[model samples]
Target: MDEVEVVVAHSQRATLRVGEVFLKVDVDPAHADVEVRAMAMVPVPTPAVLWCEPPVLAIAAVPGTALGVLGAPSPASPAAWAAAGAAIRRLHDAPLPPWPGRKLDDVAEELDRECAWLLANDVLPAEVVRRNREIAEAVLRPWTPAFIHGDLQITHVFVDDEDRVTGIIDWSEAAPGDAMFDLAILTLGHEEHLDDLLVGYGDADRDVIRAWWSLRSLTASHWLIEHGFDPDEPGCEFDVLRARMPDS
Candidate 1:
């Protein structure tokens, strides 16, 4: 067999690797205001350290699984979040530490700043950002702080024929904070998953989920404007993320 180096680009960054094991790196050109912060690993129970040195890095054991989407979502409809909530729940269950990552105030502040920046850039209006800031602050306030698989979208699931999650990757944004934020990410991205993972989460009011989902959407929309991309024609799912946020 022959090996060639290829560059794989995700929403926030690109990965360059070759051969059986490919190293995927996520780069967010603008760190000041980002939605998901480019995940190198998904939300799963897999135990591994998620870190990056200016540029993101992920050394995968799979032959070419490190490639873009790793052939996820098949030939079409790759938008559906293939990652399972149960897997994310397990990730949340992982015994972690309450260091800076777990600080509730920090999370809230970051969301507020992103929203503020987006509003300033004309990506989002003043009223929308203000409302979103309120919602974000509320969600992060008084939270017990559970492990959040930062970027919980369809491709993260990594499933099989039975629809069972085989593995979860993209943990770069993984942090200890409000679980609602992560839950919102899953629900908003995968409508079908909302019900699928209800059992895994044990049970929660639908209204509660809505608030978090809305907050997540509002916070994520900034990624486009921050990158100087046209928010109207983002040409990707983040636009849907922006649309799903709804008006205040």
Candidate 2:
């Protein structure tokens, strides 16, 4: 018998791997339904759903390893990054998902709350939080929505040895949102590959994408720490936030 391995364990969710099968345990039962439905709708490659039992969904793991991880150099070739970009393009070009994405007002309110928390908790210097928060505002405005993989982080994408995309996983957050948001999330903490990814994804609002880098780092750092992941690594989320400051 293959030993079960913990893929990820957080308060809201956990994933366990047993050989070729991955079991996703979500706190919210509705998320499982959305993930099952969204995976069916996406044109790109995704893990095959084997079965679902309320809070737990079992899926066949995809063939390839992750394209990369946040805060680490990607072993994947530039071509792999380009392939990921192309995959994202395919997703955004597809028809909108049945559900709507987050409202701008809600996002702004959350940002304000997170910023206050950061300062009050001394997680980051007040000036650092303030400057990045200002930069983040650029992407907090209205925009035409597209089919976005709401949590399109690099770790969620997988690729073969030849730099070909094999599949994408973690679909619970999939929804309609800003196209750039997906691109920004994919390239977060890995800006060096932006040029490669953009080659396949095509031109975009560079400023907005950069702004989201700041926004993503600012909003996600606290939660990551709470979940037992360090955001203060040399090239991780905290570094990303400080990168946006004027004198960095």
Candidate 3:
């Protein structure tokens, strides 16, 4: 049973809670609750089957509004970003079931489908869509996969007072693939706050992190182009992604 009533719809797949538990929809509402929440809770929040229409998904989750107001307001700040990075690291360290492939070539079909689906649905651009396909092929060729929050960026984080990360919401893209892919999103998403985050993380080379960011930069741009997203959107993560690219 859901802990709260759906007070209001905050986004396409997100909703506001009137009580403690937060209800969210990931993919395939009929799938096992465990698979739905494998991306969030550290020890598994234990989602259960319910008779509520649309499956009132029960999971331990945080509010998207709270996170957006605090965490995203200053993703470039040191204190703000460090907390964000650490939260991400903790998430990356979490165990997940392995998927079929680690090599870019292996997941090429899936990646292509994602890009294609977005494009076909009028969420991506024609010319730029091709770029996303090419980028996926290139990046996955020699990829070392780990658990990745495949759709991370500014909109995913939630922070508390004093600018500490309170929660990292949005697990729709969660998958056991490349850890670097997640790092790349975190790095590019919080470039302004990179220093603050790394201070606690120390001066680790973290090449994979760098690679993930650079590659995602290119791929994300393709997404933007396909979707006709303004390149100059204020504080938009896509601009950061482009700025961080070495070749760009």
lDDT of 1 by residue, 118-178 (tens): 7677765576556545554456547666767676654455555455555555555666666
Cα RMSD (angstroms) for every candidate in the order listed: 6.7, 0.9, 6.2
Ranking by TM-score: 2, 1, 3
Tens digits of lDDT, candidate 2, 182-246: 88898898999999999888878999999999888989988998899999997888999888888
lDDT of each: 0.51, 0.91, 0.51
Which of candidates 1 and 3 reaches a greater TM-score?
A: 1
Worst 10 residues of 3 by lDDT: 43-52
Worst 10 residues of 2 by lDDT: 239-248
Candidate with better TM-score, 2 vs 3: 2
lDDT of model 3 at position 237: 40
Error of 1 at 182 (Å): 1.9
Best by TM-score: 2
